[model samples]
Target: MTARPLWTSHEAQDATGGALVGPDWNANGVSIDSRSVAEGDLFVALRGPNFDGHAYVADALAKGAVAALVDTLPEFPAHNPSLIKVDETLAGLRALGIARREAVGATVIGLTGSVGKTTTKEMLATAFAALGATHASPGSLNNHWGVPLSLARMPHDVRYGVFEMGMNHAGEIADLTGMVRPHVALITTVAAAHIEFFGSVEAIADAKAEIFQGVEPGGTAVLPLDNPHYARLAAAARAAGVTRHITFGETAGADFLLKGVETGPEGLTVSAVAAGLPLTFHLNFFGKHQAVNALGALAAVHAAGGDIARAAAALEGLQPLKGRGGRRKIALAGGGELTLIDESYNASPAAVAAALGVLGAETPGTGGRRIAIIGDMLELGEQSAALHADLAGPAVANKIDTVHCCGPYAAYLWELLPAAMRGLRAPDSTVLARSLARELRAGDVVMVKGSLGSRMAKVVEVITSLASDGAA
Candidate 1:
């Protein structure tokens, strides 16, 4: 085989915790999980609070990893050669990422929000791809290790890059922002997510504001005018000395204002005024919430100096992330269609409400009903039950005909809903899903949503299985 994929050995040294020994070898890519290591990959043995990757070094080498960034070398069969010692694997990874960023000089866009950050990252990356070679963080890889891994993965020749930066604690964003030093940053919105970590909503806002700390001097900040904290976020960006600021929303005075939005079976039609230009876009994703996300994309692309028309045109083909409202059509037994709205990846009060709004917009088939198959929202700490129960109001207001629930907190919501609105509730998602599948019929719009920890998406899987087996 060809020589192991090459990375600057010096680059690996700074990114990892230890010293570079041979100075001749390099790595193709950095990997924290040994299972994913491939030939020419640099395996970093990260010892987390609950797990240690050091034990897997031998397996990674056996699998053909080029080098191992480790604090302590694991005993392996004789004749293994790829070992790069490090002090702290995570620190080393961060150093390597920063070193690469300094060397590559790619245009970086930072994105943060309580919701939609991952989807927005994909949207921006898709749009950016139309203009030039681009790189974006995979999934919701916006944490301590994720940030570094994403930055490290960025191709040196990439003209544009997008990094999604997320924080569950107070100082996390500040630390990440400093490392990214983004040229253009976008805050999707501030919602009551991870509120258990902070004392109040204002504290959450303060933490999210930390994304501005990493903005390069004279760089632009993009924010949402419709968010309640819009002014506060804008002020924070300015206080951090951001030289340019842009706003996107349906609200008046936004620099990239969404004038109107119409959703159909095809997708959504967005009329907007951006950079003092009139524009209209037919985006591929569904819902008014997505139109707002598109606005965020527009602002970032424009702030990055790309054409708004081109960005809008590029959004038409963008695919939704699975479990985030990506549509799945299932044919019913009686010659009709059952549309599944998969929002089961995660949820918050704001996101739940938004998903209901999308459900409200969905046009059910003839003689079909709108059903909401929901699970509990996690991470609210003391407010978890109340938040779960409170969703009944939104469900009623949105005209949901039936509500199916699973999980402990979901039981609270089941009790809270009016008698006529309640469909089924079980101690677990399996029973709830079974009941839902039996009751579901053609022309029904079923929305599945809950925190990922609740395992709500399993119900979507069940529905899909039944649809495939001709049981629905």
Candidate 2:
């Protein structure tokens, strides 16, 4: 069966108030990147401070974009390129998103938090996909342009829409949520992820609560009951005219209560109570923090009128995303393989502690060592040094065999770590990646982690490259 077109030329022109040139064409998808534009896609020429998509308009068209949405016409090479000329491409994209949101009947869920927004959004999308056709934000596309781009990409007939909203400072989520107008607003938990911008976690909670501001009339709010800022978020929700609430956590009296969790080599077996009924499910991923994320996701699913049992069952198939606790086995040159846990995406103090806890639970192979390659946790403001130093306790408590610390902030952690647990300390990940790669041995379980700015993935890449090098 032929798929229905996402947008026709007429629809695009009406949505963006743009003048169309060349023959009418239908776009099955929308994209901002010229390099990844797929066949039958509507490419929007967005201008950023560092780069301009207008320069890539020809490339996008030649690559397979059915039509290009642009603020200014680009010079073409002896060909009539289909174009939608608008006053501003960014505004045009936002207009397209607004039109798409109004067109879909999907139950939209707006999610935000200091951490776990991407994981919970993925979980919600996976669970909802089991119930019906679902559309979710791709990766960490939870910012200003990401939110609208995700919305505009949603299929008209989707049954559920899960939009992840993120922020570095105040009021960011509010603007994104206004465009989403979700039926349910979910805040994973308030943490010190971006404490550099906000002086306190309370301020961060208030910023996250902005997700509730655009909740549709009679919409429900899903909150983390165990978080210290739960009350603040609830009050904020009420202030935003959202009265119904669903809370999830290990705390007593939570709407969705996490009763217990058992960790193993494969994943976590979670026991919880939803509303009043007992529930049990297995997540093919590690971390108690993830268990809480699951509860929040299930609560959002429930609030959105989805089947709780089905959603819970679907979680069993959910695995961790790359750079977020996903594990892989790297074959060593001499003999046995070593396990690699990729947590190199982003990190905060709480997130690092949680990762260490997961590391502690793993029973290593015979003669295997539990190794941690840690990069700096960014955006802590005045508390940066103290917070970095505080990780020493979790490392010690978790019984990590060796720790490779990178970045200047991580040096504070290195200084605080016990002499026996210290492996290597470098000024940056690039320096540490080389030494860490050469030091890896058979039967070792290594976990790499850092904030995006820290470039910790380079270490993970260097370590994984051993497999090919060994083969060669």
Candidate 3:
């Protein structure tokens, strides 16, 4: 129901047979992944770096796909609707999204950063939903095909749009934002993620600042003031001729300033002043990063001309993304419980620090241990070892009672920890996870974190599996 073709013949003419399909034979939606393709959806068979979606064309068709967009058409069932062969399916999808955005006059908000983009996008979407009809990217579907797919899926009657832009390299954000042509652009904060690719933190800032480049002239720019490179991004926003600028963070200059933060059993309680209005609210998500995400959401909602208090109230039901700092209550073997903070989706130094800060504030069940099970932080380039070693301070500051780590990088932190804190360390996750499973107590507040490549979620799985089996 989210996507409808703007032109049936435009796609048909671009098809191999050229304008053979009727003008009324247009699709109701578009999808790149076959599993998510709904009935009457146009299936785009994109060739990704890993799997080729072309192999799933038959699957899509069988599931009621109206048409197929592909580089090469495969043999289909006799009753199949139509196959549109193009130079590149990915390119075709992009073109359709670009055309759709131009035709529809919806205001688009583009968001990008080293961390928190997805969470912040979700925040913005929830806040906007409280105001009017809203459309947003699902999960971390903020990449190349994901961005266009999100744009193409925009409902015709949506009053506002939020698009999360992401990249692991330079120029990717620029290309994505240009396609989105967002009227409001926000950089959550420039962090040292993908440092391996950019070679320095400044390059990361420059890449994140690319979000401002695609903002329409006289558009608003929302930014963070807590980051050291805030001035650089501020300069970039000014240079882009952004008509309105909004800053969010704990800084005094921030238009929306964090007056107070209270983390608790339910969720995060936040107090802030935005546009000279004092606002107090609670967010459904956990972590200090949620506060930052809320600020970004506030800035976005204010830019969209919504009532900030109403938007703030909407945050109460905003749930966190799975594998992205959401809390899950786990029953222990001894008839008690503890909360699991699943930050297993990805990791970086900045993200780890932020997560630790959240852990530092959480109050677990009576006499419970504050535990951290962390894996490698990948793609640090030359700073990998030192960065790993640097986590000990955060662990101590966060009052983590026990530290169980895996991977070569985590070993650095394991050795650097004081004699009492390090409970387990393994070259790989399997052995370390097995040991960690044995150490869970009835009242332990455990946080699991690691990069995607580190597969640290396996530890969370192992712990949950044991708990499910009543072993811990």
Candidate 4:
């Protein structure tokens, strides 16, 4: 079936308080970037600190956008371009998003957490798809502009909308959540993810709890019963006018509780209960942490009045995400095999520990060793060095045979490791990439993790190139 129109020229004008400058037109989608704009998309020209999107109005039109939202109209070609002229572009774009959300009429689930927001967003989107058409935040589009863009892109006919809200300082999630007004609000878990901006983990949990501010009347708030900040979050939710609450975790009193979970190199089987109904499903991704993430997803689905069993069934095809926990099996030159786990997107002390647990769960091939290549986890504030060194216990406990590390902060971990497990340490990723490439052997299981600033993906690339050949 042909998708319904997202915006009519009159509707766009009324929604954004802009004036239509050309012939009436229709948009099938909404976009901010010209390069990715679809044929019938409404491209919103945005202005930021570094760059101005208004400069690309002509480029967006050339890319086949049905209409463009511009503060200042650009010079057009022979044919006139459909345009919406407003006094300010960014505010106009946000107005359009709020208008879209009010019109879409889909059940919204808004989630926030220190880590796994993106992963859980993806999971919830997939689970909701089991019932009907679903729309979700793209990538990590959980910030100010990203949240608006995701909302503006929501289809009017969608059955469900899943949005991820992220924040560094306080009140950010509250501001973003006010616009979402989700029917079901969830907090994945609170950790010291952006501790640089906050003084304590309690402050972080308080910030995450802000998602409850937008809970619609009669909607439910999903909390993690296992987290230490549960009471604080629950109190905040009730104060925000959220009446119903559902908790998901392995701890007692959780409405959605995990009974047992078995994880393997390929995937994991989850045995749990959602609101007292037994649920047994398999996740395409590995990681014991994912079991909790899965429970959160199921809780959100159930709270949103979706088909829980069908949603669980849809999770069977969910695979490890790229730049998150993507896995690759490369045939070694010596007729053996090596597995690579890429967790090089973002990192924190908790995320690093979880990745180490995943690495430890898998058994290496015969005559092979378990290797971990790591880089710095940034934004740790005054406790950076101690937190970096804290990896010693988790790494050693995970049975990692060797470790290759890089970055200034990560040097603390290198110094803390025993001489037998210390493979190499470099100041940057470039030198470490070469050293790591040279160290890979057949039958090895290697896991790479670091913050985005560390560029650990380069190391994953080097190892991948060597995996196709003999030694690096």
Q: Residue-pair clashes per candidate, as listed?
A: 8, 0, 0, 0
The residue-by-residue lDDT of candidate 4 on 301-326, one tens digit each, is: 88988888999999988876788998
Candidate 2 vs candidate 3: the lDDT winner is 2
- Displacement of residue 464 (Cα, Å) in model 3 is 1.4
At residue 106, give the lDDT of candidate 1.
78
Q: TM-score winner among the candidates?
A: 2
RMSD in angstroms, candidate 2?
1.4
Which candidate leads in lDDT?
2
Alpha-carbon lDDT of model 2: 0.92
Ordered by lDDT, highest first, the candidates read 2, 4, 1, 3
The true-structure Cα RMSD of candidate 3 reads: 2.5
* C-alpha lDDT of all candidate models, in order: 0.84, 0.92, 0.83, 0.89
Error (Å) of candidate 4 at residue 336 is 2.0
Task: Write model 2 residue lDDT over 1-472, tens digit each, in one string.
Answer: 9888999999989999999999999999999999999999999999999999999999999899999999998878699999999999999999999999999999999999988989999999999999999999999998889999999999989999999999999999899999999999999989888899999998999899998889999999999999999999999999999999999999999999999999876898999999889999999989899999999999999998899999999999988888999999888767778999999999999899999998888878889999999999999999999999999999999999999999999999999999999989999999998787667888898999899999998998888888845441
Count of clashes in candidate 2: 0
Better of 1 and 3 by lDDT: 1
Better of 2 and 3 by TM-score: 2
Structure candidate 3, residue pairs in collision = none
